[model samples]
Target: MKEAGATRTMKRAVNIRIESKQAEQTQTQQAKGELYEKNGAYYLRYAEPDGEMGQTTATVKWDETHIKVIRHGDVQSDLTFRSGVRTTGGFTLPQGRLEMEMYTHGIDRKLNEGLGSLAWSYDMYTGGAHVGRIRLRLMIEEDRSE
Candidate 1:
């Protein structure tokens, strides 16, 4: 099988569902979030339940087989991930929940060759505090020449 090539950019939107465990959190905390991509860098805005907000930026790199996410922040919890077209090392955040559903093309051949679509859930904790959790589902499809 032939490996796929990376596109210049990827665009996706996720619908967030508030779990029972997270319903009691502050609405300002949820509303104070932003996602932006510019010049190959990604930016994320996070708000804490206590009404504190912070921002993090990362450089996104991708190939046919994997993705590399490097973050710039004072804390290591700055790096995070979502499912791409192929298998990837996902991410964890400092607070709240992030869920992603990914769709790809021409991955069945890779599965037959012992490389399978990647799926995972990550929960990041600091001390006894439930920092955050992320869930991702990846889907693969075939590319169309037409």
Candidate 2:
């Protein structure tokens, strides 16, 4: 790991494929973004459409034990995922912030040299009621076009 005051971040244009499955519905979204490494962790930074909220910036960082997703701009959040752990995180919307929690049951990752995939499955809850089981998968690769 680098020192606390020293950090290295390499910005690389990358093509990403994100797939999420909730209940019987599955949504897939793709975008081009930058993937970087800093403080001994890998992070993916991207922009996503947010309907009336315009564009939302998303940053996903992960290590061996946990994964964190953060959003800024219109909609903001910081959600953490870990195996056998329930993490509390909510969404900040235009109207108000809605509190939510998620219990992660499975997490798997295999990344090498800034190119690979990672996945996780969890159950989401709102107001202490079970919403649905969500499975998310991400595939990342270095952009060859540079």
Candidate 3:
């Protein structure tokens, strides 16, 4: 781990694949962004189109045990997922705000050395109602120019 303020920045091609059971849909989005590491945590910053949210900037921060996703722009949400733990948070959208709970099944953090991936699966709930199971996978592209 580097010092608290020391950060290593690299241009990384990021691929995000999301699978939702309730919607019965699978979507894949790709973007090039800056990947930073500091204080033993990884941060991936990217921009993508989010339907009603227009263009949204997504910042993914994760350590070994937990992953928190924050989206800013037209929509906003802060969700924390950890293994063997149930976390609650609220999602803000154009329509309104909704309280949600996430029960993470597992979080696998494999980003090390040069390149790897992070994968997690969890169940989402809102207002005591079961939503769906969601699986998210993020892969960090290697820099071949080096």
Best-fitting candidate, scored by lDDT:
2
Model 3 clash tally, residue pairs: 0
Per-residue C-alpha lDDT of model 2 across residues 1-146, encoded as one tens digit per residue: 22232244768899989999998999888878898777777789989743654679999988667899999998898899999999999889999998899999998876775567889999999999999999998899887985
Clashing pairs in 3: none
lDDT of 2 at 79: 91
TM-score of 2: 0.90
Candidate 1, residue 124: CA error in Å? 1.1
Task: Report, for every candidate in turn, its global Cα lDDT versus the true structure.
Answer: 0.32, 0.84, 0.74
Question: Candidate 2 — what's its lDDT?
Answer: 0.84
Tens digits of per-residue lDDT, candidate 3, 42-93, equal: 7887785446557788888887678999988888888999998999887788
* Number of colliding residue pairs in each model: 4, 0, 0
TM-score of each: 0.26, 0.90, 0.81
lDDT of 1 by residue, 42-134 (tens): 322333323222344433332334333354442222233334342223234566434332222221123211122333444444434454544
Question: Per-candidate RMSD vs. true structure?
Answer: 11.8, 3.5, 3.7
Q: Which number leads on TM-score?
A: 2
Please give the distance, in angstroms, between residue 113's alpha carbon in candidate 2 and its true position after superposition: 2.4
